[model samples]
Structure formats: structure tokens, C-alpha cells
Target: MQILITGGTGLIGKQLCKALLAEGHELTVFSRNPASVPAKCGAGVHAIGALGEWHPGKTFDAVINLAGEPIVDARWTARRKQVLWDSRVTLTKELVRHIATAGRKPAVLISGSAVGYYGNRGDTAMYEAADAGEDFAAQLCKAWEDAAHAAEQVGVRVCLLRTGLILSNKGGLLGRMLPAFKLGLGARLGNGKQWMSWVHIDDYVAMVLKLLHDSFASGDQASLALASGPYNMTAPQPATNAEFTAALAKALHRPALFAAPAPLLRLAMGERAGLILEGQKVLPGKMTAAGYRFQYPNLDDALGNLFGR
Candidate 1:
């Protein structure tokens, strides 16, 4: 299959591209810098600086939309918020427009979203059927998914990946925490009770491959039902902040003796701190029901794998 991926330079995107290429799929990565794309994405992947760079009549078998600004990088000032919205919502609109005009429409569009679509629901287990919250994250995900869903009208199967915290050794939430925790400065946030829905990078990539495979096999009437709607790309078990901290510290052979108070966090990060202090216990209902097995379903196993413990 020929797959076109936006944001193919990102942490998850790079790994996904390599995996797809290894499986004998042709890859075209849409990148901001075409020159750097080869270095960033490695060989066997074509890179385009702009959508217009593609030939007018060219089309992909599938489109994976993962282009977006890093959500928790900085304070969510008005400008920062706008950047986030434009990167996700605006980029998605453009991708859909490309799909609409393509000579051969892609069979599937796997768009990225977040479990934050459920907002800070505390302990309430989130599922695809649950209503989204009214918060900014929720609103952002809703718009992102809605934009991608537009392709369904073109007879394209659309799947929204409501991703959670992605755990990887190279870079992501866990990477940033390693240096501090190695020095025994590991700490929990806001009493460490908030639920954290996270996934190992391996499982994340596997789920995506599964979805793409389903799309490839779904050309017939019976198989067409295999890929549709939102699929939560998280581990089966959702870990709390405290549990995550404990497991990471154990894996690192470090002491988790510090706690960042909620007040301090809020003062430092402003509204962005809510992401750490408040979280939802999201479940991968759709993925599980569809028979997708997670490579790392628990915090302990995931941390152990990452830390080589």
C-alpha cells in the first residue's frame, strides 16, 4: 500500500514510517522541509515540502494525519492556543481538501486526536461512545475528528485516534522525565491521584498498522465494517499519576520522594497545568473489541521495558 503521512517528522510519525516501510509499504512523508525529511525519516520514504509538490493526479492508498503542534510544550496563551488549533484543525481541513480533489480518493484517513477529548473527568472511564467535554482540549479534538470525518462522505473510512500520553525512550513524556528521575528527583504531580491514560510506543505503532491493514483488507462489503469511527490508542490499563511515578522510580532504581503541589504547578504552567493535575481514566474500548492486543498494557511493564529493567 502507498501511504501519505503528514507530520512524518514527529516522534511517533518517524517510527510509524519506518515500520510501514519495513512491512513493504511505499511511504510519502509530507514535511515542512523536504531536504531534512530524508535524514529525519530515513531511506525508502519520499518527502514533500508542500501538498502542491505532489503531481496533480497522484493519490495515496491511505492518509495518516498527525501534524500538530506539541500540546503541553508551553503556557496556553491566546497565541499559543491559536497555534495549536491551526496546526490541528487547519491542517486537517487542508488534508481533507486534498482528499476531495485527488484523482483516486484514499481508502482510509487515520487522524490523530487525544483522550483529553473527555476533559478532566477524574475517575470516569472514557469510551468512544461517551460525550466529549466542553474544555479547550475536548473542543480541539472534536473539531479535528469532525474535519477528518468529512472524508467519509467521499466513501473513505475515517478513524480518529484519541491518543494518550505516548511512552518512548527516544522522546516524549518519559524521555523528559528520565534525567530528573535518574538523579532521584522523581516527583508526582498534584497529590499524584489523577489518572493517566498512556501507551507504549510499540503498541501505538502496532495499533496504527492494524488499522491500516484493516483498511487494505476492507474493500469488500463484509470487511468494510472493520475500520470506522474513533479508536482509543491507549493501553488496556490506565495508571494514576502516583502509580506511574512509583513504577518509573522502581524501574530507575530511584526514590520518588518529592511532590509538586497543585498550587505551584498551576502558578507555573497556568491553565496548562490542568493536564497534569487532572486527567481521565480512558479505556481503549473500540480497539479492544476489535481484537487489538497491546504490547504493553500496564505501567510497570511499559516502564520496565523502557528502562531496560
Candidate 2:
């Protein structure tokens, strides 16, 4: 299959591209720094500086949309919020427009979303069918998904990946917390009771590959049935922030003995702090029912795999 991917140099995109490349699938990556794509994503990846490069004559079997600003990297000032919105929603809208005009439309569009779509639901279990939250992050994800859903009208299968916290040896939520955990400065945030839906990077890549290949490539009725719509890209067993902290500390042979108060986090991060202080217990209800198996369902197992313990 020939694939075009946005954010192909990102954490998840890098790994996903490697997997696709290993399977002998041709990949074209859209990047701000087109020259760096071959170095960052891998050799043999054709890089495009703009979506316009994909002329109407150009064709792709599949399109993976993962471009977005790092939501937690900076404070959510008014400007920063707009940047987030434009990067995801605006880009997706443009991608769909291009898809509509394509001489040969892709069979499927695997677009990115986040578990933040559920907002601060506390212990309430969220599934793919759950309603959108009213918070900024949730609204952002809803609009982003809505933009991607436009491809369906053109007869393209659309899959929205409502991803959770991804655990990997490289950068992500785990990368940001590893330094502190390794030094035994690990602490739970806000009382540590907020539920966290997470997935190991390996499982994340595998699930995506399944959707790309099985859902559209193969003519399996079950696969086609599960091909479109939202999927909670999360592990089966959700954990609390406290449980995640303890598991990481245990995997690193360190002690966790402190807490980051919610007030301090709010003062430091402002509205962005809600991302940490509040979370949803999202489950991969659709994925599981679709017959996808999880490689790392437990928090301890996922951390152990990452730490090689």
C-alpha cells in the first residue's frame, strides 16, 4: 500500500512509519521540515513540504492524519489555543477538501484524536460512544474528528483514533515523568485518584496497523464492519494517577513519597493543568469487540516492558 501521513516525524508517527516501511508499504510524509523527514522517519520516505504537493494525479491507498501542536508543552494562552485548533481542525479540513478533489481517493483515512474528548469524567468509564466533553481539549478533539469525518461523504472509510496517554521508552507522557521517577522524586498529582487511560506504544502501533490493513485491505466482513467510526486507543485496564505512579516507581526500583498539589499545578499551568488533575477511565470497547488484542493491558506490565524489567 502507498500511504501519506501527516506528523510522520512525531513520536507515534515515527514508530508507525517504521512498522509500515518494514511491511514494504510505500510512505509519503508531509512535514514542515521536509528534508529532515528521511532522517527522522526513515529512509525511503518521500517527503512533501505542503499538502498541495499531492496533486490530483498523485494517489495514496491510505492517509494517516496525526499533525497537531503539543497540547501540554506550553500554557494555554488564547494564542496557543488558536494554534492548537488550526494545526488539527484546519489542517484536517484542508486534507478532506483535497481528498474530495482527488482523482483516486484513498480507501481509508486514519485520523488522530485524543481521550481528552471525554474530559474530566473521574471514574466513569468512557467508551467510543461516549458524548463529547465541554472542556477546551474535548471540544478541540470533537472538532478535529468532525473535520476528518467529512471524508465519509466521498466514500472513504474514516477511523478516528481517540488515543490516550502513550507509554514508550522515547518521549511522551512517560518521557516527561521518567527523570523525576528515576531520581525518586516521583509524586502523584492532586490526590492521585483521577483515572488515566494509557497504552503501550507497541500496542498502539499494532492497533493502527490492524486498522490500516485488516479494516480496509482485507475483504473480511467483520473488519469492514469495524473499519469506520471512533476507537478508544486505550488499554483494557485503566489506572489511577496514584496507581500509575506506584507502578513506575516499582519498575524503576524507586520510592514515591510526595504529591503535587492541584492548586500548585493550576497556578503553574493555568487551564492546561486540568489535563493532569482530571482524567477519564477510557476503555477500548470498540477495539476489543472488533477482536483486537492488547499486548500491554496493565499499567505495571506496560511500565515493565518499557523499563525492560
Candidate 3:
């Protein structure tokens, strides 16, 4: 398969590209800095500065839309929010537009969404069937998914991967937390009762492969209908914030002796703190029902695999 990926330099995109390349798939990393793909994704893969840079005759078997600004990197100021919105909502629209005009459309468009679509549900468990909330994150995901679904009108199969917290040693949430945990400064956020739905990066990448392969088999309406739309790319088992903190502390042989109060977090991070203090217990109902098996179903195994504990 020849796959075109946006945000190929991101944590998940980098690993996904490496894995797909190893599987004998041809790749093209679409980026603002095409030259950086060689340093980030290594050789053999093609890189184009923009979709416009591609020759009119060039096409792809699949287009994975993963380009988006990091939501949690900064406090949710008006400017920051616009950047986040434009990166995802705007960029995805452009990708879909290109697909609409392409001489040869891709078989499937695997667009990125997030578990944040459900909003801060406290301890409530969320599935693909759940109605989305009205928060900024949820609204953002809805718009993002809407843009990707436009390809379906052109006969391209669409998969909206509502991914959870990706746990990997290479980078992402776990990488950012490791130094503090290793230094014994790790602490629970708020009361630590909020549910955190997560997946091992390896399993997350595998889910994409599963969906990509399944698209080929989704010839008739029945098979195609069963596989498309919002798939919660999360583990079967969801953990509370307290359980996750304890497990990380135990894995690192460090003491989780402090608790960061919710009020302080809100004060420090403003609205962005809601992402840390409030979470949904998302379940991969559709993905699992479709026969995708998880490599690390439990938090312990996932942490162990990443930290070598």
C-alpha cells in the first residue's frame, strides 16, 4: 500500500510510519518541512512539502490525516484555541478537498479524532454509541470528523479513529511524565478518580493496520458499514486516575505522595486543566467487536512494556 500521512513527525505518526514501512508499504510524509522527514522518519519514504507539491498524476492507496496542534501544550487562550482549531479542522478540510479533486482517490482515509469527543464525563463510561458533549474539544472532534466524512461522498471509505492517551516510551504523555515520576515528584491530579482510557502505541498502530486491511474486504454495503465511522481506539479496560498514578509510581519504584488539587490545576491551566482532571472511560466497542485484539489490555502490562518493569 502507498500511504500518505500528515503530521508524520508526531509521536504516533513517526512510529506508525516506521511500522508501515517495515511491512513493505510505500509512504509519503506530507509536511510543511519536507526535508525534516529524512531526519524524523529515515530514508526510503517520500516527502512532499504540501499536497500541492505532489504531481497531478501521483496518488495514494490510503491517506492518514494526523496533522493537528498539540492541545495540551499551552493554556487554552483565544489564539491557542484558534491554532488548534485551524490545524485540525482547517487542515482536514484541505485534505478532504484534495481527495475530492484527486484523479485517483485513495481506498481509505484514516482520519484522527480523540477520546475528548465525549467531553469530561467524570466516571461515566463512553462508547462509540454515546452522543458527543458540547465542550470545545468535543465540538472540535465533531467538526474534524465531519470534514473527513466528506470523502465518503466520493466513494472513499472513512475511518474516524477516536484515539485515547497513547502510552509509549518514545514520546507522548508517558514520555512527558517519566522524568517527574523518576525523580519521585509524580502525583495524582485532583482526587484522581477520573477515568483514563488509554492504549499502547503499538496496539494503536496495529488498529490502523486492521482497519486498512478490512477496508479491502468491505466491498459490499454490509461489510463497509460495519467498519466505518467513529472507532474508539482505546483499551477494553479503562483505569481511574488514581489507579493510573499508583501503577506508574509502582512501576517506577517511586512514591506518589502528593495530590494536585483541582482548584490549583484550574487556576494554573485554566480550561485546559479539564483535560487532566476530568476524563471519559472510553471503550473500544466497535474496534474489539470487529476482531481487533489488544496487545496491552491492562495498564500494568502497558506500563511494564514501555518502562521495562
Winning candidate number (TM-score): 2
Clash totals in order:
0, 0, 0
- Looking at model 2, residue 179 earns an lDDT score of 95
Per-candidate TM equals 0.97, 0.99, 0.97
Candidate 3: TM-score? 0.97
TM-score of 1: 0.97
Give the top-scoring candidate (lDDT).
2
Which residue pairs collide, candidate 1? none
Model 2 per-residue lDDT tens digits across residues 122-236: 8889999899999999999999999999999999999999999999999999899989999999999999999989999999999999888765746677669787899999999
Clashing pairs in 2: none
The C-alpha RMSD in Å for every predicted model, in order, reads 1.1, 0.9, 1.2
TM-score of the candidate numbered 2? 0.99
Worst 10 residues of 3 by lDDT: 218-227
Indicate whether candidate 1 or candidate 2 has the larger lDDT.
2
Backbone clashes, candidate 1: 0
